[model samples]
Target: MKKLLIGTAALAMVAGAAFAESHSVVRLGTEGAYPPYNFINDAGEVDGFERVLGDELCARAEMTCEWVTNDWDSIIPNLVSGNYDAIIAAMSITPEREEVVAFTQNYTPPSPSAFVAMGDVDLSGSVIAAQTGTIQAAHVTGMDGATLLEYPTPDETVAAMRAGEADAVLSDKDYLLPVVEGSSGEIMFIGDDVPLGGGIGMAFRKSDPEMRAKFDAAIQSMKDDGTLNEMIAEYLGEDSPAF
Candidate 1:
């Protein structure tokens, strides 16, 4: 979802001096619930592609960094409230979000969104599930004759479909691929893959251009030396998109 201005003061801060000070320890906010992108590992630590990428960017930028978990619905607002210095969540760069924050250059190329269902059911006029506040949710909302069931987490979206409460669950193909493969013929991909959002990028409060620039340069460095693509393959599989 696009960042919502929490209040008049929060709106003013976003418009005024949001994150003006240099942070010695830059806090990266993310949705710890999103897998492949991010998740709390069995060890109860933040672990995934973003965790690895965030650490490398912090190292290349020569800054001490820490990870902070937030629910996806409020991730952007927490950054605006100074709860974190930046968002490294697998957030797509979109004009609606750009109005509230600035994005570093994309770290991953645009990825397609897709749907999963039990059989060859048509999606038109069917009830579809999507994580609340996600591009998938917004897309399903606008689909002709489609009914949307929104959940707070990605897992719930899939769960609803499994329980037969939803005809299908829509999300990033990268996130759904493993689930479909593991379903043992119970679930399968359906319908055409839908391109959604721009490429994924890190976000900073608009006032924190310096912090944004630091990571942007670091991301470009990774892209230049091929470390970024290697990491993407390591975590997101060989077929995943590179910079």
Candidate 2:
């Protein structure tokens, strides 16, 4: 969900208008809806692990990281199209996607994406909603007899599932845990089989290897210095995920 208090229309208004203007200033894109990773804050600013991590790397790279919040589905295409300098969203490293834009080293190791069918509901022939352009969608595509409904954000996907527009929804387990822990959908994982080992990474145009390398080194250092964990705890809460 590239969702913020500012809806998709407002997000697209700024996202579509953004461009990398100065080499010294790197323009980064994020979904701003993936909590613990990126999301809107109470003060109306983008804040979360991914957002803070981007800020950290920008500080390390000695370059200005100007953030442009956008829909997750458009992040890669727009990067390839040269609309931004980098993408700091929680994007996965999938072979299908690598054919388009390039990615930094995995920031967050691959966590299994899961399908939550209502209760002990059977997902054998159900319609599943997933964030479009995600590995979860690709996995849903492979499930036999299941129809895939792609939404731009997980929030929309969940909303659709709640409205009876979709039978189940697919997303990373960590993100879903926080949102669905007490939701009244009888929601539960369909199964843990067919896990896709795809890790989330920062992304950029394939043409920007040098910049990617710079950010990669910066990110790793953050992980080494305990900065990453601190930020993760800050956004996802103290009882945050270990994955």
Candidate 3:
């Protein structure tokens, strides 16, 4: 749900012009692995919450846009390199990440982080699995006497727990809730929820304030009209917090 890696390279204005031109394609990068937030459908196309929300935002902003999938680990660097214009992946607005890429105002409210295990397990001194480059991983790293097993994807963290590689898996609760429910009692939550990050927002290269401002206005528009809250309930869950 959160990632931070330093990327240093100025985005050229030629590429910035793409953000300026009417009907020009703005590539929105995402992992396409995290679901409900984002995932590839059976049609092998990027589909899910961000896909719909992004399309609406682009339409409101009067820009043409397309989806681009990249590994979670490299999503930020690629954006800095102009591989994509922005990141609409379910990324949280953490100060660490803000050091590298400027974020549009958050679109989704902060969700809880949670721990799930094969059965009820004590979190103290337990080995926990978390996705690489996520806030959960960073949080687990500081837990006293708890070992953190890092995986490169959300699915891997769950797989690691199922394989007995970790006592539990730590991740965004929204992503883990479906897994826990579908596990048929095989996995259950083990601890109080942990809240991390400011909220979920789109990330853009630091050089593209114009692009950032454009999307921010569109997002603010949604928040004002209650469409953002409607989409949050539809995509995230009815209980998810509103703007």
Query: What TM-score would every model get versus the actual structure?
Result: 0.93, 0.82, 0.93
A best-first ranking of the candidates according to their TM-score comes to: 1, 3, 2
**Pairs with backbone N, CA or C atoms under 3 Å apart (clashes), candidate 2:** 1-153, 1-154, 119-186
- Tens-digit lDDT track for model 2 on 114-221? 667666656778888988766777677887998989887788988898899999888877678776677764676677734464567787766677788888898788
lDDT of each: 0.85, 0.71, 0.85
lDDT accuracy of residue 127 in candidate 2: 88
Clashing pairs in 1: none
RMSD of each: 2.6, 5.8, 2.8
Which ranges of candidate 2 are over 4 A from the true structure? Answer: 1-22, 184-186, 233-243
What lDDT is obtained when candidate 3 is compared to the true structure?
0.85
Question: Which residue window of length 10 is worst by lDDT in model 1?
Answer: 1-10
Q: Write the per-residue lDDT of candidate 1 for residues 1-243, one digit (tens) a residue.
A: 221222233344453345544556888998888889999998999999999999999999888888999987777777887888899888988877777889999999988888999998778889999988788888888899999998888899999998999999999998998899999999899989898887899999888898899999999999999999999899988998787
Writing each residue's lDDT as its tens digit, candidate 3 over 77-124 gives: 778778889999999998877777789999988888899999867788
Instruction: In model 1, state the lDDT of residue 165.
Output: 97
Model 1 TM-score?
A: 0.93
Which stretches of model 1 miss by more than 4 angstroms? 1-22
Which prediction has the highest lDDT against the true structure? 3
